[model samples]
Target: MREVAIIGAGMTKFGRSDLSLIEIMSEAAIRALEDAALGDQKVDSVYVANMGAARLNRQTAIASALVDQLNLFPAMAEAVENGPASGASAFKNGFQAIASGMADVVLVTGGERMREVNNLEATDFVASMSHPQAEYIYGVTLPALAGMFTRLYMDRYGVTAKHLALVAIKNHANALKNPYAHIHQAITIEGILTAPEAVVNNPYIADPLRLYDCCPVSDGAAALVLTTREIAEKLGKPIVKVGGIGQATDTHAVHERPDPTELTAVKIAAQKAFQMAGIGPQDIDVAELHDAFTILEIAESEEAGFFPKGEGHNALEQGVTSLGGKLPINPSGGLKAKGHPVGATGVAQLVELTWQLRGAAGDRQVEGAKNAFACNFGGFGNNVVTTVLMREE
Candidate 1:
């Protein structure tokens, strides 16, 4: 297979958006195309990733609408949905399109306008990803699952609410440097957990998970332009090769997993990506873990091989995952502060890493970053897609 590299990346601010889903996606795509300096060149294919436009916005065939909106009529258009992993799944498809010699230039864009519906309805729409008989039938929301997972993790790993708060504080601070992050407000342990008004300020959403522990429901889009290495070199852009991509799935229901606290899919998928990239977790300079909840940051860090199984919280307390640390995680604030726009999240993670690799991430940039990693968790860790990206010298 031919090598595939990302030539351009762009994203919309992660928050409530007035623009329609197609329009949001088009905006990100146009920015990416312009970044690639396509100069009127036609794209060979366009892949759109989204989770709930049909359910929330009452729209379908979004890929075709985006093609028309962008005037890319003849381009092969398709929509991909893989729960919350939709963005990365679409990206994998686009990568295969180029690597398999079927297409030269591919546009992969992901967007979700989840705020169009009420908060409760939006939550239910996302909850549809759960198992039909085991999870969704009983109304097992994502937060409830996360809360239980957090409680179990705390028991096994000695992670406390303070450690979770550290994740929130660190990511929130990083988001302040990210112009596109959803929550710009800076938080502190005192404000969220320790202060007298903490109870009212950050009330419990689930038993152990509080309001601040969960990612906000957001509307946003992100896009990337991928091409052959030869084309990337000719474009005179920074070559950020798709070094490796790996995906894995666990049981349909989280309860079916052998160990509920262990993210087996994340571990297996990350190992595949690292092996394919000819590297290991130690070689990753920066990472973007799907931190939909604060506990996930700790759990995924361990599962992705960045920390020991039960010591991820220790790494957190030691400042190892901070921005200036040896391995800064989530320089773009992750799903915690960046907002979780389900469909857009996976693509957004890559967009952030592309910028990190290119040294273009303004304030949140990780200095001298050469290799980056990202994990896009789906369906409570039942499905995951892991990626490795390297900057070519």
Candidate 2:
């Protein structure tokens, strides 16, 4: 396969935006073009990774629609939706195009505008990601399922509620320095712990999980301009190479899993990515983990081999995952602090890692960042995609 490099990465500020889906995605695409120092005329293909423009905005075929809106209508355009991993799926496609010599430069983008719906409507919309018969029909929202799993994790791993709050505190602190992050409020353990006492404080969502523990519904988009290593050299831009990629799937219904604590897909995908990159977890200088919930960040750190099993909480408690810690995770504020707009999440992971590897992340930058890793799990670990990227200078 030909070497693939990310010539540019660009994303919209992930928050409640008044912009429509097309507008948000196009804005990102335009920025990506500028970052790559290329004009719209240079793009060869377009791959979009949005899940719910139809349900959220009554618009569909957003991939082709984006092409026309960006005046790249003649280029090949395709949409990929692997639930929340949709953005990573799009990136995989763009990588294949470059590796196969099918395209020299491709615009890989994903976005979602979800604030238009009320909270209840938004919850119901997100539920559509799982199996209709076994999952969604039971009125299982993502947080409800995650809360159940969190209960299991706590029981099995001896994790405490305080441990989970550490994840939130760390990400929120990191987001404070990220201007593009959705929620930039720096939180304290005392604030989260005491806020849930009164009705105005941290309200309980599902059992064992409160509002602060959950990610906010957001409207956001992120894009990357991908090209071959040769093309990158020709453009004379910083080259962030795609060193490795791995994707795997698991049973969609959470109840059907043999071991709920073991996200088999995540372990397998991360293993493959590490093997392909010829590196271990220790080689990951910086990481952007999928933190859809506070517990997820903890679980994923262990699953990805960044920390030992049953000790993920310990890593966070020791400030090991903080911005200046031994290993920095989610310096972009992650999905928890940055917001989870479903389909846009995975792309945002890569966007953050690209900036980190390029040393462009100002305040939240990991010191001496060289190799970066990202793990994007879709549908509560049912579908997992792990990517390992490197600075190819």
RMSD of 2: 1.3
Task: Give candidate 2 misplaced runs (Cα > 4 Å).
Answer: 39-41, 194-199
**Cα-lDDT of candidate 1:** 0.94
What lDDT score goes with residue 3 in model 2? Answer: 93
Best by TM-score: 1
Which pairs clash inside model 2?
195-201, 195-202, 196-202
* Total backbone collisions, model 1: 0
TM-score of each: 0.99, 0.97
- Compared with the true structure, model 2 gives a TM-score of 0.97
Model 2 C-alpha lDDT versus the unseen true structure: 0.89
Segments of candidate 1 deviating more than 4 angstroms: none
Q: What 10-residue stretch in candidate 2 is worst by lDDT?
A: 194-203
lDDT by candidate, in order shown = 0.94, 0.89
